[model samples]
Structure formats: structure tokens, C-alpha cells
Target: MEQLLYITIGGSTHTATMVSNAATEALLTRLKSSPVTVTLNSSGGFEIWGALGFSLPATDEPVNAQPGDIVLYNGSNICMFYGTNSWSYTRLGKIDGLSESELRTFLKAGESNVKVTLSLSNTAGLQSVDGSVAKSNGSAYTLSGTSACAGQKGVCIKNKKKIIR
Candidate 1:
């Protein structure tokens, strides 16, 4: 199934349709634990780019990125376009339901240190490995009866209560 990723900037949230790839998979795994916030700066009069503070697998290819395109650069940085650019980048996803002008305004084009938070839309209908419904128990845990750490994903137990991270 196609996954939707949410990007929030300046109190407005936008959705992106994620591509099915190792890089995107890794991103989703990270977000399952917590949202990622990056400080981006406008660049080349075309895009806002920044470091992700972590690396994802890169399968770079030549791409003529258009407005709303989000791509991974050098395995660690993220670039969100508001204009145009041609480069070798790992395709991440594209922001949905916005026009060019709206994208520019939403991205705060030409601005520096713009805060962008990436998260997963609330996951519904999630099932555990044993085909059980998942719930929250105030704390998170793993299905193996262990505590779910900050970076762990999947079904977990919290005080013996089932939860999905």
C-alpha cells in the first residue's frame, strides 16, 4: 500500500505520497518512533535543503526535480523544492495538494533555518504480528515483552499492554 508522510512547517501540515524504496522504508521506520525535525535553508533560488542528522540508504539517480519534490542528498541531507533543479538524488516523495505559489509560501522559500517536521499520519488498522489489534498503554514496548527504545519500531508491549510504534 502507498504510505503518506506528513510535513509540517510554520503550523501548516502538508502530505506527501511516499515512494516504495529502501530509503523511504528507513525514513518511515525512524518516524514510527518519533517525528524528525530539520532546520533547512533556502538554496539556489529553487529549493530548501538541510541535513537530516541521520543517514538513509541512497539510490541516487538523475532527476529534474520540480516544485514539491522531496529528495535525499548524499545519504544524509533532505531537499524540498519550490522551484526547479536537476541533480542526482534519491527520490523520497512529493508534497501533495498544493500549487507552486502555495508551495513557495509554505516552504518559506529564500528563508534560513526553517523548521520542518516529518511524521507519519496516524496509523490505523495496524495489526500485530500475531494478528492482534494494537493499542497504547502510556508507555511503549516490544512484542517480545521488552521495552521499546527511542528508535525501535513495530508492535511492542508497555506494562504488558499491547502497543504499536
Candidate 2:
């Protein structure tokens, strides 16, 4: 089955169809445990790049990255393009259903320290009460979509029901 990567920035989520590669496989495996949030900065007016804080297996090859293209650089950094660049990178995935202008806005072009979260959607179509993709372990999520423990106060979703704790 094809896997989807959900990239959330500024509360707006975009989906990407993951490419079949070792780098992507490693990323999915890491995301299975929890979502990874990276602080990215705009570079060269073309892409938002950052260190993933973890390294992935890379099979670097010449790539002409275009808008919406996500790639891994130097085995540890992640780059999301909003303009264009030619570089050797490990292909990760490409965002879908967004135009160039939309990509710029969604990626916060020209911004610094933009927070981007990467998560995976399960094949079962299970979602948190807030309609965000559920964690791989099916844990309850808070209204903002982060994993919530029983001790957390405020509204949370578990098994598709809203529960106030």
C-alpha cells in the first residue's frame, strides 16, 4: 500500500505521496513512534531547510528539486522546496494539490525558524477525535492533535469520542 506523509505548518496540513526509497522508509519508521517537528529556515529564496536532528539512510543522486519537493540532504537535513534548485539529494516525497503560490504560503517562504511537523497516516483510516491522523499506537490526542495523556486537562479525543479530562 502507498503511504502518505502529512506535513503540518501553521495548523494547515498538506499531504505528500512518499517515494519508495530507503530514506523514505527510514523516515516512516521513525515517525511510527511519534511525529517529528523541525524548525526550518528559508534559504536562497527557494527552499526551507533544516536539520532533522536525526540521520536517515541516503542514496544521493542528482535531482532538480521543484516546488513542493521534499528531499534529504547530507543524510541529516531535510529540505522542502518552494522555488527551484539543482542538487544531489535523496528523494523523499512531493506535496500534492498545491500551486506554487500556495506552496510559498504553506511553507512560509522567506521566514525563519518555521515549525513543520511530519506524521504518517495509518492504513486503517483511524483518526483522532479532532480529525487529525491518529498515532500509530492509537493513542488519544488533544484538541491541537498532540498525544494527550489521561492527566491532561481540557478536551481530548479517544475512539472517536470527545472526553474532557
Candidate 3:
């Protein structure tokens, strides 16, 4: 199933989809309640690999990564890309709704050592409170849609255990 991950940098938050795999699931499990923080570094001659740092305490050798992509480097580090890289990396997720330029700008904001966050978004269809995806009615759920969360099949805000499918 597709999973939604929120990437917050400073004040701006970007939406991303976690790739289906052992590493992704493990990462999510670690981040189920709280997010992990790490320093993001700006790299490459043209800053194509912006915010290209952080470690997740998990690892898997996957192969490679590209622009707008998030990956696990050597098993425990989270690498967000503004440019492409050839290496053994497990993909974490891909940020949505941002152009190449927009992504580059956001990632390269500080040029070095920027902080980023990864959190779970209920739209990931993690299953209802009873471990089922059945529709939970009432104000517990709302359809507050946004460009970042486009093509959503359902939406549930923070502090509420509700899902619309």
C-alpha cells in the first residue's frame, strides 16, 4: 500500500510517498510516534545534491537515487536529493508537488546543515484504529485537501484517529 510521509523543513512541509519495502516499513516503525532530526548538507558543484545528509539508524543496499528522491545511504542515513547520484541506497520516498527548481530552492536554502523532519500522514492508509481501513465517520475525519496532497483518496488531520476511504 502507498504511504504518505511529511517532510518539514524550517516552516515549509512537503508531502512524500514511502516506497514499499522492508527499509521503508522499518523507518516508518521507528518514526511512528516521533520524528528523527538530522543535519542536511548541501553538496555537488551546482548544489544538485542539496540537503544531502542525515542518518536514519537503518540501512539496505538498494542501488541508486535521483532528484526529488529520498534514500537510505549505506543503511542508516537519510539522503534527500536535488540531483542524481549513483550508489547503493534504499529509497525512502519521493516528495510530491514540487518542480525541479522549487525543490532545488527549498533544499539549498541554507546551503549547509539544514534541519528536516519526517513524519507519518494518515493518508498513507495505515488502517483504522481497529487495524482496518473501514470508513470512520463524523468530525473525526475531514476532507481538507491541498495541492501537496493531491490525488488523495482520503484525508485525516492531526490528533484524530479517523480515515475516509
Q: Which candidate number would show the highest TM-score if scored against the true structure? A: 2
Q: Which ten residues in a row have the lowest lDDT in candidate 3?
A: 139-148
C-alpha root-mean-square deviation, each candidate: 10.9, 8.8, 8.4
Q: How does each model score on lDDT?
A: 0.82, 0.84, 0.61
Best by lDDT: 2
Task: Report the Cα lDDT for candidate 2.
Answer: 0.84
lDDT of 3: 0.61
Candidate 2 collision pairs: none
Among residues 3 or more apart in sequence or in different chains, the pairs in candidate 3 whose N, CA or C atoms overlap within 3 Å are 55-77, 56-76, 58-75, 59-75
Tens digit of per-residue lDDT, candidate 2, span 1-165: 788898888766668989999999999999999889899999999999999999999999999999999999999999999999999999999999799999999999999999988987421222334434444455776555556766866666676676777
Per-model TM-score, in order, reads 0.73, 0.75, 0.64
Candidate 1 vs 2: which has more lDDT: 2
